[model samples]
Target: MMDGSMFIDEWHPSDHYMSEDLTRPARHRTRTQSPPRYYYIDFGISRKYDASNTNPLELPIYGGDKEVPEFKEDYSKPWNPFPTDVWYLGRAIQETFLDRYTGVEFLSGLVSDMMHSDPAQRPNMDEVFSQFQVLRQGFSSCKLRSRVAHDEKRSVFHFLLHWARRIQYIVRRIPPTHTSLA
Candidate 1:
């Protein structure tokens, strides 16, 4: 999580560019060490299915990006939600990074494939990850390393500040009489 509050997948403008205030020393500036790694969270609704079960449970689409065409009422048939997840991820990446940044043509095709309207056309997670590995190889070493370094530094600062605040809160809560315990 960037800044301990925003998820990288959520795609806020701040995630792409650091504001001056955030870059200041007080905010615990991020170091430019390695490429930033993203983590997926919020798995409260996640489920596991056995591979033998050809017909996985298909409940009516409830939460998530409302723009998914398959979620329409007219599409009464239950469909695998996995492809929907791919679409959402693609859309998030496109809208958040590709749309705002330039010189990432390598990712455009992959993103397009992921966002294909037909779920059958979309590549599976393994294929997507493989493609990403290939594409990442094309990035300039300096650029990739610098980006990672910056994010790492920022993360360190955020971690330290969070702990500091917690400690401060606990210290304040201690009774004054307990300050000089024998």
Candidate 2:
């Protein structure tokens, strides 16, 4: 099942901060270091079904995010959790990333499909991954290396300050997106 608990502060490793800011430093300001790794947890509701069973149904067990469309219509009916998992992932990305940042417009199509109200209309994991690959390949390395700006407009002072840091990052060849050492 797609539990919203998949991502939380506890699941991510702490970063080695070089500044006093309580939040994560901006990409340009971040020091060159191994990127933090993140993983999922809370498998209290997870299941492992036989490979032969393509459609396994289970009763709803509400997760961290209670906004799933399927569960809203009928709470007691048995439903396949696979498509719901796709919805969870799509909604998570939509809320956590797309809504808050710019430069990821390429993901809109796939996210829309995954979050379809009709579960059967959603693409399977393999299709999702394939589409993601195509999207990823479409971006040039320079585009990928460019800074991801926030959706909100910054004040004039902040904008100039951000550009100053951006120039420094460009000169130093610091990547706009952090990478894992492994």
Q: What's the C-alpha lDDT at position 157 in model 1?
A: 76
Evaluated at residue 114, the lDDT of candidate 2 is 98
Error of 2 at 58 (Å): 1.1
Global fold similarity of model 2 (TM-score): 0.68
Off-target runs (Cα >4 Å) in candidate 2 are 1-35, 152-182
**Per-residue lDDT of 30-142 in model 2, one digit per residue for the tens?**
33223344556778988878988879999977888888899898788999999999999999889877998777777899999999999999999889998887777677756
lDDT of 1 by residue, 114-168 (tens): 9987888998767888888777666554334222222234576756774564455
* C-alpha lDDT of residue 42 in model 1: 80
lDDT (Cα atoms) of all candidates against the true structure: 0.60, 0.72
Model 1 TM-score (2 dp): 0.58
Most lDDT-accurate candidate: 2
Query: Which candidate has the highest TM-score of all?
Result: 2
TM-scores, all candidates, are 0.58, 0.68
Candidate 2, position 75, lDDT: 82
